[model samples]
Target: MSSETKSPTPSAGLKSNLPSTTTFITGHNAEGKAIVLDSRPATWKSFENGVMGFNQIYTNPFPPDLNGDADLHFHDDKIASGNLGLAVKNGTVCRMVDFGPGYVCMMHRTQSLDFGIVVEGKIDLVLDDGSSTHMKRGDIAVQRATMHSWRNPSTTDWARMLFVLQDARPLFVDGVRFGEDYGRGTEGLPRSGNDD
Candidate 1:
């Protein structure tokens, strides 16, 4: 495996071969019950800057040989390959996303309510109003009707986090969400074209 795939595993208060003190969450959730997810520390300090473990996966819509760092990063950030997403509701979703080491998203506006939980590392978030704030692990912030962008004021360390967002007017292909190519028009979801 490549170095990118060789990430340290936060297990039982230890990483790689280093001995440390920490807590790892291990549990599941039932449909009708309130799920209080636990994200125990991998040690006294095991922050991915912002990267959380949400069962990351990648899907290549082309030939398989396009597996490299540059390609992977593009897929991870743009195509959202490395990012793992969990559906919270029809208009809300959860994802483990990376902001960066020197991450820049050129200012943009998003009409959504974002509730972020810092899982690892740190972030210096810049809002549309030019307001900024620093966020660290275990910290949570709420962004409402805000035009904003994210930055990791660090040079050597990247930022990661668990983001829970509710789309104000999220685009949908059919009766679905994000990446409107799923279940909708031609080459879309497997719908019978019936307006229910």
Candidate 2:
């Protein structure tokens, strides 16, 4: 038996992994009846020669209903995840990311805490402190509003990760608040696309 994991290839015109089948479940009426609100294949957005794939799962509005056992919210599909915009105040965003071989994202920061899990292949989590760690399938990463990047060094493999981001206080340094900096410290890297 071979120990190599299979690398993903794009499906026809799709420049990313096979679309994810997402089913959104929610509660209905005052009785909290469970129901499937929507179920569809996730639409992928490609970046940097199809080296990266982005598919948003959902976005919760501000002040998530704490009083209700079942929360009814709307997701705005028009906004792209690459826009570097945070979710609504006290809100959260869920997404899936795919990294192709030789893929490396710019070192950037977001104003939200992120929980990520690797679903396939392996990747390197590069941090702003000149450090990195290799992550493989089933590994979970809890990023607390830190400056970081994703690197896929393999030349014949791809990596996929799912992330949940929640709004958080900006990183404060010496009494200065440093919020999301998408292109910060990304010199010498591809500027257009491949950012999240």
TM-score of candidate 1 relative to the true fold:
0.43
- Candidate 1 deviant stretches above 4 angstroms: 1-90, 169-196
The digit string of per-residue lDDT tens for model 2 on 48-119 reads 666786676766655565344323334543243334343444667787888888789878877778898998
lDDT of each: 0.44, 0.66
For model 2, the local distance difference test gives 0.66
| Candidate 1 lDDT for residue 191 | 23
Q: How many backbone clashes does every candidate have?
A: 10, 0
RMSD to true structure for each model, in Å: 13.9, 8.5
Model 1 pairs in collision: 49-120, 49-121, 49-159, 49-160, 50-120, 50-159, 50-160, 50-161, 51-160, 183-189
lDDT tens per residue, model 1, 1-94: 1212233444422122223222222233445443333333222222242222232223222232332334344434533332322221223444
Flag regions of model 2 displaced more than 4 Å.
1-14, 29-32, 65-73, 77-88, 184-196
Residue 22 in model 1: lDDT: 28
Candidate 2's displacement at residue 124, Å, is 0.6
